[model samples]
Target: MLISALLVLHVIVAIVIIVAVLLQQGQGANAGAAFGAGSSGTVFGARGAASFLSRLTAVLAAVFMLNSTALAWIAARDVGEPGSLLERIEPVPQLQEELVPEDEEDENERDEDELDLPPPDSH
Candidate 1:
């Protein structure tokens, strides 16, 4: 449950990071301002939106990385717990069979009989 919540948060942060990066202006975008784009070009005056978005992207990236690490840690820690399909499956323990000399001879004969097979071309 905690992991699920964390995963959702991580996804949200990743999306926000994408949005934040997209919102920022490119390096050459400011070159136009030198030509005559005017001092009132941006709503933030100069570098307000870019600085804010870049900082936001950086913070969200850190959050995404931390959440990923947490999810991995939880999955590894709960590897043996009964939740997932692999975890729910309990391995069947092998039983020790006592063998006698007489039993061994009969078992060997049965094993040889089981191993007897026709060639693949016989099919």
Candidate 2:
């Protein structure tokens, strides 16, 4: 129960971290200033938005890492007895034997019954 709660928190923080990172502007965003197409200042004032977003992202990331480690530890220590794959499978039914032909058996008997006799004396 505790691990499950932590997992949920971890997922939520991860999503927030992603959103925070995406919301921040890239370094290249300032390039517009070189062509005078951008404002010399930001609405957040100097470095305001960047610093706040970066700090939030860092904190959430740390929490996410700690939660992941806790989950791994819990899983490893709480595992139950191992089971075999063969034990879960159902046994197959035995097949009936097919009948043999009578003629084949008779041929074997006849071969055994015949006795080897010497050829007639060559006069």
Best by lDDT: 2
**TM-score of each model, paired residue for residue:** 0.52, 0.55
Which residue pairs show collisions in model 2? none
**Count of backbone collisions in candidate 2:** 0
lDDT of 1 by residue, 52-108 (tens): 778888888899999999999998998765476876677999999976767447544
Residue 98 miss distance in model 1 (angstroms): 19
**Which regions in candidate 2 have their CA more than 4 angstroms from the true location?**
35-50, 81-123
Question: What lDDT would each prediction earn against the true structure?
Answer: 0.78, 0.78
